[model samples]
Target chain A: MVFDKKKSPYLFLLPFLIMFFSFWLWPILQSLYWSMLEWDGLRAPTFVGFRNYIKLFSEQDYIIALSNTVSAAIVYIGIMVIVALFLGFMLNSSILPGRAAFRTIIFLPVTVSLPVIALVFFIIFAKNNGVLNNIISTLGFGRSIDWLGDPRINLWSIVSLRIWRASGFYAIFILAGLQSIPEEVIEASIIDGASGWKTIRLIVLPLLRPVIIYVIIASSIWAFQLFEEPWILTRGGPVNSTATIAMHVYRNGFQFFQLGYASASAYVLTAIIVVFALIQLLINKGK
Target chain B: MKKVLTAAAILLLSFGFLSASGAEESKAEGPIELSYWGWGPHVVGVNETISPAFKEMYPDVTVKAEALGPWDLMDKFYVSMVSGKGAPDAAQLVRRVSEKYLISELLYDFTGFMNEYDGQFSEALNRDVLSVDGKYLGIPLDYGPSALFYNKPLAEKLGIDVSTIVTWDDFYELAVKISREYPDLYIMTQYYPAGTWGSNYYRMFMQSAGANIYDAEGKVIRNNQKMVEVLEFLYKLHADVKTLNIPVNDPLMWEESRKNNILFYPRNSYFSGEMEQQVPEMDGVIHTIPWPLWSEDDDPQYTGNWGGVALVVPQKGPHADIAAEFCKFFATNVEALTQHWYTTTGVPSYAPARDNIIKDNTNETFAKGLMEAITVREVGPWYYTDWAQTEKILGDGLDNMFGGKLTPAEAWQWTEDQLIKILGR
Candidate 1:
């Protein structure tokens, strides 16, 4: 019997296709459908026809959550890129003593569990007896600051946590990009009377563009979905100051049982992330 | 071609075998196993006390009670209900949020069983909280009868007699005196400008004044005089006495209480367990008193509820009847409830069981306060489907008030307007 190559290939792909369709594609389609209904997860759904989406736009909490998520993401990506790049350059320096030790120390937070880190930060940011406040007081600071309680500073605190957890991990990626740059290119540039800063600005940064773009896009996506840290630390509190779109989705779906509304919020979040990633890609391509 | 066909046949046979194995396991006859889900001390009660008692009553059946985080338990249960699989036969659900499930029609109707056990549980809990269209969907496990948890040592040190505080006016005066004398120590911690806990605190005061976010008819009463008054009192407490601005449930607040920096804490009976667990050193140092009345002339001052849980049997569970029976037994059996009390330190909603459970001085004080303050037939607000949304709106308004951006009346009006716009009610 002759085995038809086309049919054989189709058969080979069948299992993966089935799994993907069942798990990923089906859920996305179902969520999209549910986004237009007014169901409470178990109740018979009513055809709401974008009513959930309309309501979401008018809801102040959702607006605040969207603003917080976008602002935090922008700040997070900006700081993470700069800090990671700096750390990456420092680690890549041959003249820097204990380079391996410094890399390990900086990258340690990446290996630590996020909940543990958030909890540790919770203690550190405690208003009265926290480590940070204690240090401030010892340094003759007049009073303890309510780091996690103040609405103005709470979102920044969450951003600091995101940066701390991820900067080291991204720095390793940056370090890899730096290592991939041939040593000869740098040596030739220096031989041709190029300053160190000039070489990095004109050569290293351009070459490192792909890694930086990837980091920015990945961090933006992650920031839009930020939940566990703020949840464990502040629970998006001090008046929803740090509530993210993902947190709003969980609240609507699980806490409020507004599954349809939650699905709508989720789709909006997806759109935002997509638009953000596309903008970054377009900018990179333009450059 | 032959090799591929053989591999496909083997895979098909393996799938068939696995399917057959699952079917056989389902069909296997033995002792019936019922899964129960709960959280916190109630889960402990179910696993250690209630489940054992249940098994003793039904020797042919076994009960497996799984303890999960409060939010995790609800999330898992809701998912299981929606998927129609892997749900616990019986689960403990918070009374406030149970309305969402009740409206979903996914809960087993316990009306018949509830009727049989009528007059056994507290009338306040059974009135309309767990009922929908006259169908009882859950059995009341406990009630969070509210009270004041005061630091006895600190009160004595400040020469303040908690017994003399009858009205909120007296309480406020005492708070001011404490602020004047001990500037470093706060009279109480308040969750102003915070999330659900702040809303809860605001609601507690509202209930104390015989007002709530909704009336008995389920209409919005959030902008009423009583609500504004509650907010006004809270604002005054914060502005004048300089109450520690922290969530009562926060670890920082508990730490402050442990350090004797907080002189008083208004909380429900469920906090009795929390106090013992969170601040064990304050076992004797802390004591309970009835919550002060809203005014001197307020008749039959009602205690406010903070948190309570009820046992529910899901309609989709494998053994609905058995689960319902188990829930009834767990809730109404004096012996099981006595065990529950020992394990949870909770005030049983079953009135008869309340008498059987032994208590320490603090718990006794809490119980006495509950009996005295719960004189009114109805206790607290009936949490509706939009309760979570209401909480967010109210919390935001409280934050504004505490932030000095809005007055109490302005905040109350803003919250009501926002609620009307969002909830369309």
Candidate 2:
């Protein structure tokens, strides 16, 4: 081999490029190829053109999965952002004693394993002898509501868990944003006879937009890919009310063994994620 | 530094080339090593006993057994099978999830091997599960025939002769009587809307009623009159009578329910061992019985099956012969079956082995009851193929009915439409 010292830097990049192509780039390309086939994962992948995509679009379960995911992302993102901001502000506020302790308490959920947390919540939300249901029954409700069993309430149950688990992590970022705000700016607002709420509305809120946007984007992405919590808690049941699109992907790929169809669903999910992310970016740009 | 770097580059290139060529060396075998994949702790323990026994029969063929959870096994199978790499020579596939892979035709047909056994295997599995168009796809390892496990103490306390409750209606009457006496107690903790309830018990009830959610051809038959009648019957029993209690899936809660509250649980015989393991307090109190019928007149004497695993050889693997022999040995040989049974808590799929077991151990009423129910009826061919999908649809309907979102009639409609949409009817 001809050696050139100047080109050796490019040689240094070769290993990384090879790994990237082998692992990441190759799989994406392979996925695209598999998406157009009729494969059950074991047999030779038969070319089906666009039929898998067409079939996916027509499936009610897919629609349910998508709608459930989208609704969850919207609701969870909205609530998470607000709660995160409040906690962030509280943790960042100089007047609040034991702010570190409060931050630690809030962050505890984010640090705990998702499946473990889900198991704990599954117990707390069981129809009979559950912590919450027992409390409800003791408070004069004749019968305990099946928190995880009732379709109407189950999605909200998952949403509550998502919010509880996510708020702390989001708040940490928001807290960073809170800290970054110039102390002089708040002092000036207070000197101008602005009330605490008014100052927060005018100053903190405006300055925290970028971090809030980041939080929203990250949280929405997490919400869209919600799997373990609902999977462990309900297995996407009480009907398909809690079945997220990712769960559908998993069910198709693993359970049903429809790899081609699953790949199509996956690409569509990727497109959805891209579109949502782009929308967030466009909104941020517009602002 | 440059000399060292140049040497390193050459060494790396040589290593890659060596590895690429080293793949061919796998063919250079003195002893055939067959890789057998299975799941759960039982897989390892069972294989530990079976491997040596298998080697004793065929000393030249070495067995390499591995275990993973059911889902993980599927995952590994997918990764290996799809890429045409790392495929196990044989695997213990969960029968419920095995049908989808049959379409791939990747499994080595065991019809010849099964014929070699010639009536040694369980008759019901030979007819229903393993056979596809006169070809056997795999050899059955074991089966989980559904049976009713009741708390004898609870039944005695209530003066309920559970054995006399031949029909489901009679069982419901027993439930009502018990509930009248003890308002807090329920017949069982049914996992509703979803869970094993839809997968196991509902299917058992439907089969006992001479109707299944899907026909043999994988067509939706949920709207069949028998199916509708059964749904209505269960609806009334669950909704009106309110016999089910504690709709939860937690092990702790399950332990509590089995120990204290629930009276009658219709589960598979596979759970008989686990019952004692899970709640040791209920060890002597629990007894197994044949699943109650919808009516005395219900014919074909059919029943439902729960979880089971089967051994299959992958066609793409190098050692099909050794894998097939291993599968045959495990499926047919009395020694291997007995070892598998004792080690893994598995009931042998081989009739002779099963007979030997039942004959030798007459005291385990659960196993004896399971043996009697085993040859009766297995799941329809389409059951495992579309299991997850069917479960979701039927599960939703069940949820709707029990959650008070829809009446049984409306839930039936929902299930039918959903199945139609999903199954492309």
Candidate 3:
């Protein structure tokens, strides 16, 4: 059944429009509406304008979750970017042997299931008979510290796992960026008697700025959305020290059924991510 | 064309009549399918055994049990309830998660069905726990009463009289003594504070001591003197006495504790299954006793619950009456509960079944202890609404106190402050 040429485009687009409205756009608007109300997912929502948003900022739990997420972003991104870049820099070098094998090894973690990774790390980080603790004990480290039990250290342990899981994927991206850099430029720099460090600092890094920005943007978003690692490993505990904003939203929404407040917190988290992304854009513009 | 149309219409009418006759036939004699959602092998085993028995009793009804983890079941339950679609006819609901669903009016009230077994349950659950307004919401399936499970061999070697410790203070002294004599073998693992504030241990201890986070009227009472006292007691155990080991539910910790021959592990009846299953070597070596009291002067209500589930029929499901029938069959039938006790490890809440199991297994220390302990099992007001947040607050304070970051007073104060702020009290 053919439509007239002008109407055909609209006809072709109708299914997508219907889906967009029903699934995506409607939920976004509904969640925004929900953010202003007081709802336990079970009962009908009560209108309480701005109260949820106010409570989110005022509550200590929300603040702690936010700060933990920010800390994770800083710690995870810093280690991940530096390590991925170094690996990329090495793997891209003509002098390196078995580059493909190294690349595969680096990217392997990305392929493993996140929950499985969390479980494996949970075993490794176990205070007794754990692979890490055993190794540390053999090296004459005193009694095994309760790595997951101690609130002060558990978040860092979770961060380390996140770094381990993510660094490989980011390395491949950077490797691609490194490969795209012109060979002639590196040779020219060498001919000018520039030191290896100088060549990397000035030429290689400058050329890889866009890729670095991309990594930072993607990773920071991923970092802020952290739930599974901490949830499976710690359940956001040893206290809520390891809890992220995502975990808090999950607790409020699912466990407690305070969906309205959860929606408010979620929007605040989205705002934080957007602001960070915008800052990244500014940095990209400056570069 | 007229002849052909008449023949087609006659054929369609005949088919319709046959379909109508088939429906009538099935109405007289056909199997009724009922869907049940539950978690774990215990539920599966019970359903598997009970289904055949149930079918034998009522040959027309079929019970289909879908075993899933609690979280998975909750996800499906919530989505189905909200959407008014895809709900199973029956499901197991934990007391911890009952309020949210009950408040939504999603559950079919089982009051009438429950009335049939008025005197059957071993202990009558507070009606308010399974009720919203005046309507009973679900049937209590199991009881979770906290108890001290100890290693008999280790206790014997240490010269500790396990039965003599009747109070927390007495238990504390025993812990100190064990820690002093056997530094290698920790007496107990207090992993509660590690999970979250208002952790299971804290909740259980507080409830056992007759102090809950909220009063009957639903006012925040977490900052009371009783809570402060309990927190101080836990802190002293962890920080000063240094008798409490930190396991925090880790598999490695369990392994290490087993290797070190931990003398005591405080847990509910439900956890005994795990202890026995995961570390089968401790079968004859382990013994359980009723939880110690807060003080000798205080009353001897020495138990509090950690986990208990109820059988609830969803309002929007295929067969509510059949589901209720199955629930009654599962909950009150002596044969079913007896089979359940033998096959799996839930302490049946039905009096006849529970009493029979207890009488038959009087020699089993674990069963005896569980029977003695679960009598005080009750659901408090704090079980519902913002309890998770309270748990988080309690968790942080408990962790800080245990980790040497805060004193007991400070921890209590911190938790109180958070609760006051969050609860808007």
Candidate 4:
């Protein structure tokens, strides 16, 4: 008679629901209202309904940030998926010894600090004297390439580092998925005269669908919040080439102290993220 | 079920009560546990800047300063200010949106407090804080008086008469020669995508032409000939004379330039610490000159007048009058001023403080020159500075021009287009 736990799990969820509503839901609702305003954080956010969003359409910097974010996302997700699958295959390979060590090495970047990773990459790709550039120069190359200078290529420099950082983490997830695959099914595939590639393509790849979706969802969410690297490395510049929306939002809020404008931008960015999540959910559902 | 609900309600209410009680306790008199948040070499770890002196003076008002990474600090400040949580009373707000706060009714006005304590500090009070409407929201923290830091060794090595480098063209020639001579050595570190543009160039050129982003009224003025000249001049050095690949994000760029094969770096006031560190073996290897004179003025002078940090009393605090008095005390006290200057490697706002700081200053040869540079600096402190926007014009513009993406005029036009978009005028 007393609140039936089985009949109403919503009752059990009520506390979490309240906490979520108070913090996340309320801020998100507030931000949507702000997106329509003209604010500079410190001052009263004037209600310039839809002007901020209107401006966002034509703004070159925002466009650049948006594109760069897409580029980072593609590179980040692509690396995660590709590396995760490859490492999974390696982990599944019985002939390849030291699976545990390989898994540990691939998974280590996730545990390490990103700034430290960035610092290491910063030294490696430095124009005047990066380890990688030094090696390139030593190989009888004429010029020391400015890795993060060229506007078109600077985004790649960031993406490569991002790939290096994220692939290992995704590999762990893929490895877990590979482990979940029952031995009997794989043995049956092997006896059916399927080669390693065929077995992977038909048996392992098809079965790891849920894990793949999880990896995509998790990484996409992480990719949306690509602030620390862009903040640390180029700061969305050589001229707004690397400027992500998150970094821009951060700048408006903090550096510029145009909180109202920043909040509006934040909400716009949040909406964009929500759209991305929704699209991801739709895709997962279709799958 | 009833018992469980009662327990849950009690816990929630008690936690809320505890939080409110903590806020009350923070405001209480007995050993005031106040926390000041800022960004620098972690304030708590490195107890040099905000010292034990303040703690000693007000033993009851215990202050623990913490450093949040500068950008992160700004983000937290923004969030806290809006949400009304975890904001420090006297947090250092950057001077970017000091305008919006002035025009709009946001910050706690500090005019009444300033008038009351006119005796303690001198006339070095930065009037730049007050908007056109005359509401002083922010106290000047640090001034960026642009100066030309020339490596004496590098200049001597290049065999260029450093004194003859009077104009932007002349500096360019000297820089090119030094760069050509020492192929490995860049003439200077001209960073893009950061404090690269709209700074030394912007101030110097703007002052040179007597035109700025605003003209008395806080209106956006984009098309200034001088502003264009600033971009064009930077484009020349950036295109023809190759500078180092340095992104001016960290303060350490100055240090890197000095250590590497660089001749002159045009920055403001803070390069003294860098020079001191770079050429520690050679006691007097560096000299500070006025920013390389850019324009053809009747009586040419360099501009570096980025007014340094100022003290302010927050709106609501216990003993607000006493807090104002503390600011005045610290601002005036020669000993305190000297400590601030020495510890922060920041310039003293007070002219009197200059004498004490320079007397026993164990910095590089630039110490004497720096004080003189500050004295002679033509400050053009503007309120509404879109630093990111202008840097796009100068930094990214220069880079593209170098890579042959756009011609100088085309780059300028593109920049103008971008600025129009940013400033919306």
Candidate 5:
């Protein structure tokens, strides 16, 4: 029997298309509709137009959440990219001993569950008997620091957790990119009296731009959508210092039962993330 | 074309078989199974003791109790209620948040069934809190009367007399003395960063002062005097006495208790169960006392109610009547209540079952404190539909105050403003 190529391809894609429409597209459209109404999950929804969006913008808690999310994303992406690049270069070097072991150790955190990591970090950051505080005190480094309790340091602690868990994964990607650079090109640069650092800065970095760009955009999205670590560790507290935009959406939708407001905040977050990705793409395109 | 036809036929046959089995199961005349959802030791009690006794009594109705963490249970229940699917036949709902469910008309009206059990449970809980417009939506399972759980050996070692610490002023003085005398010892555990701890303490103190975030008419009280006082007291503990600020339910609290570095935990009746479960080694050494009064001369000495759970049957459940009967049995039956007390160590709100559990209890200090707390004049927070939001706002304000970002007065005002803005009240 003869098969129609076009129809056969579509038939093969049918399952994936069905799932995508049912789970992803349908919810997105439904949430957009819900974003226009003032409904607690239980009651009849009343259409409130853009009032929920207006109120969301004017909300102090939403403002704080937005600011926290943006700042954390900036800091998290910056540190993650730098650390990943350095580790990638080190691992790619032929002279580094036991590179495989270092790679395994670095990538170990990525395999463990996030909640487990957060829980372990919670104990380590405890005020009195925490390992970190105990070590500091043992070294006579003044009083015990409240890593999770202090508003000033709690968000940074969350950022540190993100970096610890994710930097290695991105480093692996950067290492692959580094390996793709031919040895002959590097030798030519060195033979032309270009020092190692200079050869890398002018030559290696330009070729690795695609991988770095991917890392920055992906990590940025993750940073904006951060929830589990903050939710488990600090619960966005000490006066909402560590609360992110995603936490705000969960609190409003599930905890406060304000479905419309939560939906509005969520869409706003989506827009911000889109704009960020676009900006990154445009910057890369210009370069 | 033949392959496609065969695949389609197989899929249709499979679905037909699935539907046939589902229909057969629905039509079969078997014993009814009531699904219940809850959390903590109470759920353990329900699964272990209550279900067995209930099965023995009914002979036709069986219960399947599923346990989850408190917040996880609440989240699952809320999602089920919202989606109008996957809800249990019966679930344990916190009394403080039950008003929201009541207002949403999600609970089965138990007025008809509960009328027969009038005066069986405590009037303060059943009549005043669990009912709305004479319609009963839930049965009181337990009442959380606040108390101070202290380490008796630690108190003796510090030369502190628990009897003299009857007032808040006295408690504060004792806290200061303990801080000065034993640099490593903390008087209590308070978490400044977590809003839950802030709200818990705020609710305890506010109810002790005979006030709440809401007035009698359900309007939020702005710049409440009682709230200011409570915040000031909490601030002093956080700033002056340097109370050990640790997250609630953190393992560190238990570790500190074991080491005698932390002496007092001002918690509710449910905490006795927690202590028994978490630090069982300190059972004989630890004792409970009534919550410290606001002043020595204050009349009646009202204590605050912190946490309690109620058994509620959702309106959408398939077996509402049977579930309500099970709930009633769980709450009121002496045998079931006794077993529940043994498992949970929680003071049941059912008056008739009270004496039975309290009479021969091994933990006499806890039992006595529970009895005193129940008999004393108590004030419970007014849980409105917006109570969760109000609690969060209040908690954030308290967090700011304790973190030194706002003064007590400023925190009170900030909380009031936030509530007004958020609730549109």
Candidate 6:
């Protein structure tokens, strides 16, 4: 059914278009404008013209947090997507029993609220009598490690926790993707005497490329703004090792009341994320 | 979209009505609404408990008491006062707020309130509040004379005598002994922030040694050889004792850290409630002893914080008389405040409140804690007492020494560099 040339193309979309403009579209434009100004969220904004961006260099914490965020995005997405794919394959396989029970267990973290996960994990990672320390001490180490205290191990600690908490959600996405793969294709590949390993590598992996690409792009975008986990877990301590760009933006905006500076950081973050996504897309296109 | 506009209109109308009600209900002529800010689950609980009574007595007058939590509440209040809106009628100020918050004109000078209530308040409260700028800022709500909290079970387990642990050397020896034996849990600890270096080690210990970090006026008189000795000694403790917390991976770590991991911390009565919140299992094991026997004759006894929350009537607020009345009533009411303290589950600032709570108190859990409150000491803050130097110069200097950024002698030089920035004289 082709639209009549006389009919208004936007007539059907007017309500949603208004909503999109008001809620999503306008805020983005406003944020972009505010990013250049030195506004404290209360007073009239002063146009600083990239001074906030320049100060980002002197801020040791912001620089460290930026690196931490980049690393988290790469590591979290890499492991989570791969593990999710593998879990999807295993869950759907005939070799696995009680798929319902297995799926429920694996998907538990996805259903759990992020704050709840943070609280539970914080309890588990407590430096002294926490479950982890109990296990470690039982191994004859005879000491509790400063899991959140020592600057060296703090960021890695957040990374491991993020992976544990996020992988299950990714698992569901990949599982749906796996289930969507045609049974007839696998049957034909099997009839052609493609080994199981060879089939997964050559046929299934390449075939699942679109779904995998979707998963990576979507998950990486979310991962780039990782905040709550690091914020709650370490509060950007034992000395700013786990501070992320989003966390810095949040603190400066809310706690420090430096709204303009926070906006600048956010805009820069958006730029970084866009560039990363573009480069990944370009590489995938070349591949 | 038009529906949304109508809804926005309705919301704006409702907000307008709210502001109108706020203005209308506010004191027009008699007994105005006094908005006060303070902390202590007790103060919060006390305000709630007393509200019925307060409102009952002053039917026309209303007092809104806002209670903020421990860590960032002060900072939030400072940001508000600086930004110029939504401030309470009166605010709870720390003794060091003069420097921490350098607003000269905004804060109400409570010299009049102090003079009027001089007869009503306790001598200790008056001394602490009156000492700052020799002018009072606010009325007293609660006090926080910190003591050395100990684990009785852990102490018994180690066969330690609390009596002998008075001097820095004596405390150090016991820590070494505890470390050698336990090896896993920390023997003694405090949070390693750059700010508390002078308070915990220098001022507190110096006060014990009978010295003050500064003179009556802000001066760097604390740069003595003994100060160097304490800083060096504490930096070495960072190496000797494992800090109460380990890495962030272990789940039970904070509980154990709050409970069995650390033997002692230089904290106030607030720690009692916090410890209970964090580790109820160690309730019986925890005990508070007076800040371990400081010798304060020779040194300016570093009794920095007597922990009082002041109630003030803002010069601009609608209800100055009502706010003052509430302040007077709340301060004098020992029974109501005792309940507030118990329910807030903290050490009461007033001596009578502590005595009332401890008298025939059947809950054996916090009984010994009640005793710690019973032995009230007045080691409060020195106002205009900018801790910036002690905090920046002395505290961060300790961290720097620990990080191997500066040696003990070089730390002295480095501290001198920071002294100028923090003190600016």
Alpha-carbon RMSD to native, per candidate: 4.1, 4.6, 7.4, 4.6, 4.2, 6.6
DockQ-derived CAPRI band for the predicted complex in model 1 = acceptable
Candidate 2 residue A69 C-alpha distance from true site, Å = 0.9
lDDT of 5 by residue, A118-212 (tens): 65787688776778999998899979888987888899988998999999999999999999989899999999999988999999999999999
Q: What C-alpha lDDT, on a 0 to 100 scale, does residue A63 get in candidate 4? A: 79
* Local lDDT at B50 for model 5: 87
Native contact recovery (fnat) for each candidate is 0.40, 0.55, 0.38, 0.38, 0.53, 0.04
The CA lDDT at B425 in model 5 is 72
- Which numbered prediction scores highest in DockQ against the true structure? 5
Instruction: List model 6 lDDT by residue over A8-27, tens digit each.
Output: 45446555655675668767
Question: Which consecutive 10 residues in model 4 chain A have the weakest lDDT in total?
Answer: A252-261
- Each prediction's TM-score against the native? 0.90, 0.88, 0.86, 0.84, 0.90, 0.74
Candidate 1 interface CA RMSD, Å:
3.8
The docking category that best describes candidate 5 is acceptable
Q: What is the interface RMSD of each candidate, in Å?
A: 3.8, 4.1, 8.2, 4.4, 3.8, 7.1
Residues B1-425, candidate 2: write the lDDT tens digits. Answer: 99669746855675586458645234536678888888654566545777878888888877878878666787888777666678899988777656666642677888777888887776656655556778888888887677777777777887777668777888887776776778767667566556434445576677656676666677776557777787788777776453454333446445455547778777776666555445655556777677777668766556667657788888767887778888887777776676555444467778888778766754453223545544444443224436766766777787777777887778888888888887664
Query: Tens digits of per-residue lDDT for model 2 on A154-212?
Result: 99998999899989989999999989999999999999999999999999999998998
Q: Please say which candidate is ahead in DockQ: 1 or 5.
A: 5
DockQ of each: 0.37, 0.36, 0.24, 0.37, 0.39, 0.15
- Residue clash pairs of candidate 5: none
- The lDDT values for all models are 0.79, 0.74, 0.74, 0.63, 0.80, 0.63
Tens-digit lDDT track of model 3 for B1-425: 87557545655565566456544122223668777888765666656788888888789888889888777788788767765667788888666556656652578877776676777764335342676676778888876667777777777877778889888898888788767866666667666453431276667777677776666566676548887888888777776454434434545445655675577877777666666556666667767787888877765455666657788888656577778778888988887876665544567777788888767765453333555555543432234445555666777777778777888888888888877876775
Can you tell me which runs of candidate 2 are displaced by over 4 Å?
A: A1-6, A94-98, A182-185, A191-193, B1-25, B31-34, B58-64, B103-105, B193-197, B213-223, B241-249, B298-300, B342-345, B362-388, B400-425
Q: Measured by TM-score, how close is model 2 to the native structure?
A: 0.88
Model 2: lDDT of residue B29: 60
- Error (Å) of candidate 1 at residue A286 is 3.7
Q: lDDT per residue, candidate 1, B87-106, as tens digits?
A: 88898887766777775358
